[model samples]
Target: MARVYISIGSNIDREHYVTAALDALAGWFDEPLISSVYESESVGFDGSPFYNLVVGVDTDLSVAELSARFKQLEADNGRRRDVPKFSPRTLDLDILTYDLEVGRVDGVELPRGEILKNAFVLLPLAEIAPTAVHPVCGECYQVLWQAYDRDQKLWPVDFTWQGRRISQASAR
Candidate 1:
């Protein structure tokens, strides 16, 4: 089985969609290693803030299959194809990394470019996989997070799933 990390975000009905995402992921792949949910200003567009997090799951499915599954799940949760790329979303899911694979695999890019560029992606990834080395950068996630210089705005928010508290808002 390959360990895959997925980034999830929702700006429309944040709490509902995020919970739905976790539920679906758990149902499909097993219990996941989830990161702290973060509330962040939308990037590349002026829209509502988004709740973002990363989830790590083990699956034998190929990259193409995983991407297809995630897209279908997003569609089921009210994701629209008619909107702009960065428009407000009910759900957005992207495969961040698939094991140690790098470059393109099954038509999807491994070690997604946004990992280093988006705080939303990097921070949550670092939280869950601090010791996992980036396939391309040859550095651990914790180190990359420490060196990250992006100016994006994001913060942890109190979140609960399956009757358990998973993330708590920081004293900011």
Candidate 2:
């Protein structure tokens, strides 16, 4: 099985949607490294605030297969990607890292910018994988996240998904 990290975000039906997505993801992975949920402003386009969290999973599925599975989960949760970038959605699950496999496929890129520049992704990821180094920057996730501007606010919400606790901090 390959180690995979996925970032999950939602702004529509805010809390419920995020919880559902987390539950769905937990069902698929053998051990889900879930991060504490955070609230962040819309990134690329204007929209409602988003609830962002990251989860790391060790899976046997290939990248493409995993992507398809995520898409299916989104569809089930009422995600519509055709709207606009950063628009509100039921769920947004991005494959941040997959066994360090790097390349482009069908216009979507793995190991994308979201993993590095976004605190929403980095902070939670570091929670799950404290020693996990950034594939490109060669720095630990916690250090990288701390180096980013602290001005941006990412608040913890009253949310928890259905799964065994990977860590005490994640448990509600």
Candidate 3:
């Protein structure tokens, strides 16, 4: 089985879609290693804030199959393909890493570039897989997060799944 990490986000009906994604993931992949949900300003476009998190799962399915599953899940949740890439989304899921495999495989890039460019991706990834090394950087996630210098901001939000509080919002 390959240890895979996926980044999930939703800007529309944040709680509903986030929870639904979690439910689907649990149902399909059993219990996953989930990171705290974060609220972040939309990066590429003007829109509502997004709830983002990372999920780790071990699967034997090939990368293409896995990507297809995630895309189908998004489509089921009302993802609109007609919208611009930076537009608001009901559900957005992207494969971040598949074990240590580097470069493109099965037409999907391994260790997605967003991991290093976005705080939303890196922070949760560090939280869940701190010791997991980046395929190209050769550094663990926690260290990368510590060294991250971008101004991209994100904060944990109160979130629950399956009757359990899985994330705590910062006290403001």
Global fold similarity of model 2 (TM-score): 0.87
Error of 1 at 113 (Å): 0.4
Per-model TM-score, in order, reads 0.98, 0.87, 0.98
lDDT by residue (tens digit), candidate 2, 6-91? 99899888778887877787687766877787877877777888888888899888878888988999999999878866577888
Q: Global CA lDDT of candidate 1, please?
A: 0.95
Q: Estimate, for each residue in 21-109, the C-alpha lDDT of model 1 and write its tens digit.
A: 99999899877999999999999999999999999999999999999999999999999999889899999999999999998899888
lDDT of 2: 0.78
Per-residue lDDT tens digits for candidate 3, residues 138-164, read: 999999999999998789999999999
Off by over 4 Å in 3: none
Worst 10 residues of 3 by lDDT: 163-172
In model 1, the number of clashes is 0
The candidates, ranked best first by lDDT, are 3, 1, 2
Question: What lDDT score belongs to each candidate, Candidate 1 first?
Answer: 0.95, 0.78, 0.95
- Clashing residue pairs, candidate 1? none
Q: Considering summed lDDT, which 10 consecutive residues are worst modelled in model 2? A: 163-172
